[model samples]
Target: MSRTEQELRQLYASTRGMPTGAAKFAVLEEVIRHADALGLVEFAFDVRMSATSVFQHSWAPEKAFLTFSWCLAAYDREPHRFGSGHEHTLLWQFKWMAYSVYQYPEIPLQRGTDLLEDMERRYRRGGHSMHAVLQNRGEAAQFTGEVERAQAYYEEMALTRRDALSDCAGCVPSSQVQTLVALGRDEEAIRIGESAVRSGCTEQPQLIYSELLLPFVRSGLGERAVEAHRAAYRRIRDNPHHLGELALNLLFCVHSGNLVRGLDLIERHLSWLDRPRTPLTEMEFAAAAVAVLSRSQEQNGGDGGAVLRFPTVEGKRRPDTPAAELAVELRERALGIAERFDARNGNTYQSTRIRDWMDTGAIGEPLPLSVFERAANSRGGERLQRLLDQVADRTAAGDLVAAARTRAAAAELMLADEQYAEAAEAAEEAIRELDRLGLTADAAACRWVLARAYRMDGPGGSGVRALRELLDSDPWGREPQDGGPGVSPEAPQRLQPLPLLPARPELEAALGQWLGYGPEAAGWSLAAARGFAAAGREEEALAALGEALARHPDADAEPTDGVLADLLGETGAVLGRLFGEAGAPGRVGERGPTGPTGLTGLAGPADRAVSPTVVVLIAYAEHLQAIGRLEEAAERLRTACALLDAHPDTEAAGRRSTVLTDLGEVLLRLGDVAAAEEFARAALALLEPDDAWEEIVLLGKVLRARGADEELAKLLTEHGLELEDLDD
Candidate 1:
């Protein structure tokens, strides 16, 4: 080994069992510097891996940022030397870069963009790159507010995983979940997340938990949120040293109304705060602590003037301290940390979060006014009422957009306090301002609040009538008027339809009117179809699907185009499901055997792109399976598997696995038990442990049917499945 490599190995061995802290990180910094002096390009990966441990344990965003920068610098010096095996390392660095940017919101956008450009450049070199590069790129785009670009990247990543059938398939799905959530596709995000979990992709429990919690809570799926929290706690229970994860869990607990448990978590993890932390962690910790403290004070029947006590450095709690005194103390501490971070690192995303936290005395941006509103609504008393009044005062001085938003927020507070008339009036005022400002989306949101307030007031069809009127007012769902204030001419066109309100019946009714009209006609149709399916109106759903299919008949034509890929995949999947449900006994796109059209028409193109070809083949195979053409279905799956295997650039390992799973099922139906077992086992090997459950169940059934009880038992044991559960 080279001297740098030898030193790295030595350090790794020395720190094998040691807990991460400032001392270990200090040594790592020196080692990285020494490696840089020696021009050890490969050693960059080693340095970064060690730094990642420190970042994870210490919650230090600076450590993550520095590590990624160093690694990227090494790659820049000698990009040619680093290839396939090293791509994962580069991907890891870039992922952390995005994470650091998110955690430290003051980080320069240019820095993140530069890193993303580098990754893109590397991937463009026509060599093997890790699947995670796409995910990292998406994350970077998301951090930079390039939502459309981010969505495209995330969709491509998902498509790549579906096509590739690679190991560790959970990563893409997990990323897609978050991206979908950010795009306001909360229900879809939750659906994707739940599917991944069911498929056994629970490796990153903390991520899964955090990502799923928000959407579930927003959608009022309390039981689901509790389930996610429990899973998160179970995963991190033995590894409580990760302060960031602990802080995130604490925040989730507080948000979910488990204040006592939140306090217990804080007390248990208090020692972690004493360790080295980046400004990001400090901000998160401070926010979580203050929220818990505030909740505790409310629970104790303490008014706004009541003093709040905190655990001392030694973790001893004092009962009587003024809340304002505590808030000021915490704010000062956060400011001091942020200042130090800014002085050392020249400002970062964390600084922005810290500033927001300090200014609002809250946990999150867009501010957690919901907490205060909840307190007041629940009769927690005068202090929260005063806070609401202050918000009203700010609204009076703010500009149009800000003033409108403040009113909507005030409306929420009023509604929570059961002041329905005030809520309605506030919402109406906000709606008028937003409408005049040409903020259609914002106006729609305000109308939703107003409608809710009307509903809560009882009797009369006022709420429904109000919603119907709002929908009618914008029948075509037009975009905000051009040249309107705050409407940028350069903004990307809307990627998806404006999300419908949570009121399913209203949304369904509005969607019914929008059929085959407007720019988002197909999207609206799909939403309606989903709503119908969820409501068990299968025939209505099928009819809606037919309308959507007619409107977007060319969805499968350009699968390589990032914008169209997700649409095509989703449409194809929906079509396949509907066809299966209909029990149709015809080939896909046959049209009475008058040659192919729609998705099937693209299947045999000699020059078809690999992604589109795979998607079309899958849809065709699904149709064949639904029509009892087992042999044909297997053939298509095998072809897809061969194509995926032959093209590594497509990174279709995940897709390959899907084919394998399907082929196994088809072969089993054909009574070819041995081949089915082989294919199923291969698919299971390519999938993560969590994702292998279904395959195990499949193979276990095959083994049992053939009276191969011993082998079935062995398979269950190897995959951590219990025979008893299988029996159940």
Candidate 2:
């Protein structure tokens, strides 16, 4: 084998240091040096933190960016060969420097401009074969919050690809698609993104999968987004270039009721990042940490929850206890590694969205009027003014708890300023007010924020516990007005966890019991079961189902008993199929498909109960189904159906025609020809005279499943279909 060939292989060796021995390193270095001597950037990563990084950078800034790029290539060659600390060393010292400068002007950015432009100009000669340069430019612009400029760059890149046939490879046109999305131009983003998925021209698996994935996520596309994401994952199964993208897509799968997909994505991302020689990245670890942390926070663990820690050194991972220590660590690292080169830059995130949330706590007390005065002059306008007024009134009325809620609105800015202690204090203060006012839900939410801040600052077992409780509780639940402690019995209603959810009597009852507002835990338990029943968590869904049945085994019961029986019977059918019959295990066709036998099984009982979250999913799923997107609709169904099988009871239960359409589709797919036809016939029967366009299509699906598509299509054409047609 050639010497160069051997060195390339050695570059990714299992045991560490440089991945290659000195001789191999020398050969590879010589090769890259030859490329650099000709002005080619073999790789691009930051190198300022290394012993010679600063010297190279200070001596020649342009050379530094290139050298850093090369170092990044080496790190990429086998990043896992290095430990997370080592990668963090390089990541902070160099990789992120570009963004730090772009986002925070306080950091030096002037030095890297020339290098950026150079990469651009040279690539432009190849008829806009400059996606890398354009992509970097987008990163830089976004980091600096130059939104318009960033959008322009990405748009131009997409346009360039369109005009040049050869340009269509690897990166795809994700630039325009996602940039438009981040800019809030969702219609165009979806139009272009979905098209790209169909075209299959994209080779950058990360970019393509993201394009495929976005229609569902950051969107109401519902279940349809599942197949798109899955298709993208399948496209890049063995492609390392798409590993990071693969990981997040998996998350999207999990979001859409594809747990297997989510878990597999985790493995794919880990395996790629875990390359031995360079060492898998700490970024992967940190991301995984966020995922776990996010879930733990969701658990509302009666006592235990996830906690976050900041790095002791500013750019490092360990969060040194005490602000002073962390600050000192940060300063030392900052002094040495702070960029004088191009600022930190990336996709829309600049950093991870998780980082943004961390840097800006979302639940602290309101800013003083002075802060609002400035905010009025800044990005926050009406919301800030309104929030300030509300907060002010609360304080004047001595309603500390009410005032605390306002703090959540203002926490972002305070957190941005690194006022962790202040944030913590405000969260705690709000919790006190809620507690004093006997507002359990409000208090619980405040605790969620407080716990987050506490965790961000240091150790956080207590914080995790608080977060867990909030997650476990029914945020949308309401309480009675007859009488309550520390609150007026006549008070209109208590704060619901999700303010937008329309109130339901049972939901309110369930939440009240969970929060210990008044009723015995039995009500909460019963309501929970009802919710699960509505959601298709049969066993839990039927806890109340059984009670309703047991109320009068014989006929001639009271009117109230009859009403309860009717409600329970309809809901009971769902519950029985979902969790299995009362004491038995969960049944098939009851919930979303799980394992091979348990499509109807719960995502685990804790998450199997009912929730208002189902309403949102059902609406979204129906919309997608109407759009000639059966696959997408199925995915949406999978997700919302899971929620349905879990929720206690719903106001706009899936009995609606839209939900019927979805159910009919699922039953047909599962080959329940008789049941599928039954559901479709019922949905069709909803209209006395004429069927709506969406319902008509749903009828068509029902017929198609029964091998009657030809007859249905003829009838539809004679009648005309318009459910998904915008003009109709």
Candidate 3:
């Protein structure tokens, strides 16, 4: 081959790895250009044939028709130049063009009939069975509301033998299910849908799932309808090609009393209506949007004047449009599109479908899409009963996000009920979901509960391992995999397992800390330190202790004497510096005290004690506090404290002292002086000689409020912090 031909072949081959979308379309277009320039008809034919399928699947029906027309013209002019496989391929593509014509009302219904006639003539010339042609004729009849003619075609097609051009076994029933649904044969639609879904077709559940949504609901199968919605919507949410199916889902959402989810779906896909792939899909989508908006207005005290945000063509949301106004506009748009189809078909089928969706009533009570909401809405055993009823269904439906959360909630209930083993099992189920969705912080929190359940259950070391693993790997994986620059090159020493404590309130509090939970992170850290100390993990205990001190520098350290004795030869040197038994250099009044080590020397290894995330949180908290966002400031500090607890390696030493001091200041601003004082004291306990002067001053304010001026002055004097800085 010439270098140009070789290059063209490489370009064509490269498309196999690409996803089916506009990107692939661009690549194929370039290949076609190159082939046309080189007078390579065979290469151009193959490329256009391939491009036709891509266009068909990627929301480009017009492009599909245009590309297929070129191939058809070329084949007609010189059929002998192309391979026999091209003939079969061309015939297969004829099926797509047959039905696609109905999606465009601009194409006369006579044009559709003529295309089918040509398709039948071609198949007869090729000596092929008329199975595929007859099948599409039924579809065409249904699309035009010729039910009697459609039924006759379907019956005749059913008796015909399968051929090379026939639709796949799974797809045949899937198409019939839609027609059956349109014909109001709800029970038969459900039955065939169930069988078709079980056997699996080309689109499998995605197609049949949406087909059965209305049928399932109308047959009083509420739960199945919900499951079908969850499963099917997830598959098609990102694909604009599934606009019609999405409309079916939206109507299902409305009839099932899930107006919230329906509106959410509308917002997500509203922009697609701007340049919709087909008029049929646009009508379907607009009709669905109208239904959702109309019902939402009813729910809003029947006030159509309430404004709802809808997406613009640029993908930004604008909320100026009133609900009633937008609904009426969409209703007109849908009906207008439907009228074009009706005029072409000489029937009202398309318009009637739109009208029916607009007038549909709720088929059942509101079903909460979220497992969390369902559990929250129920009482006592009802909560458990509701969760249990749907957890299995959601899991089976492959809704991992909902399934994981549901499992986590169930595990919590089991844990509280003291059913430890079952809690562990439930937690494991949630973890599997976590693996599928990627590690969420919530999933990690759920795992923490599992660890506690194992610890409470008995003698196995499972809980210890679980907790250790939780700390070793960041669930968020936000940390650098290589532990960041300047770290040791050699493999770090393995950490010994922490002994399980009899009670682990600190562990629970640490892992459970998240947004919207009131801040108690500093207390949790101190509690964690006490637990670690009791468990005989000296390094981790000291780390936790240091973290507590960092967060609550002024708070009293528990087992202080023991930790001091254990780490240092004696408590005197560190205690003297901390308790004012000695004075420091450069103070307002005193000489430097002699000691083998200072406060900094008492901390765990520096690298092992700092977490980048904890530091960032504290820094952000500082910014939030300065901006008068006191609640957010407090929450950030609490999160930092929780991180300190979660990561025993990230201790209270050094920088964490700032976390505690900052939290104290934020709480003080929020008018909680007592809580402020606790953090101030905890922070003070961890402060080193080089600690920030402002932090010391903040601590002084907390203590001064409670009339501890003399003690605060003494504490400041020992650190050599001048009162002159406080005067400013």
Best prediction by lDDT: 3
Q: Backbone collision count in every prediction?
A: 30, 70, 20
By lDDT rank, best first, the candidates go 3, 1, 2
What TM-score goes with each of the models? 0.40, 0.30, 0.53
lDDT of 3 by residue, 1-728 (tens): 33398888977887876656677888898888889889999889989999999888778888889889999999999999997889999999999999798889999988899999999999999999999998899989888888777877877988999988998877777778878887889998787778767664547677889989988888888878877886676567556878889999999878889776676677657877766879888998899889888988888988773455442333255565777888899999999999998898888888998898887768867665644444443343655655665566676797656655666667777677676655665666565555446544545667677777766664434464466456544443454322331121221121111111223534533542321111233344445544554554434544544444334322122223333223222222332332233211112122234345322232222335336435434644554454466786676577666556556565746666777777888898798989998887777677664665656787777766677879878967877766665553
Supply the global lDDT for candidate 3: 0.67
RMSD after CA superposition, every candidate: 24.9, 21.3, 23.6
lDDT of 2 at 167: 33
Best by TM-score: 3
Candidate 2 local lDDT, 522-561, one digit each (tens): 3443454445544555444434433333222222222233
**lDDT values for all models:** 0.57, 0.43, 0.67
**At residue 628, what lDDT does model 1 achieve?**
73
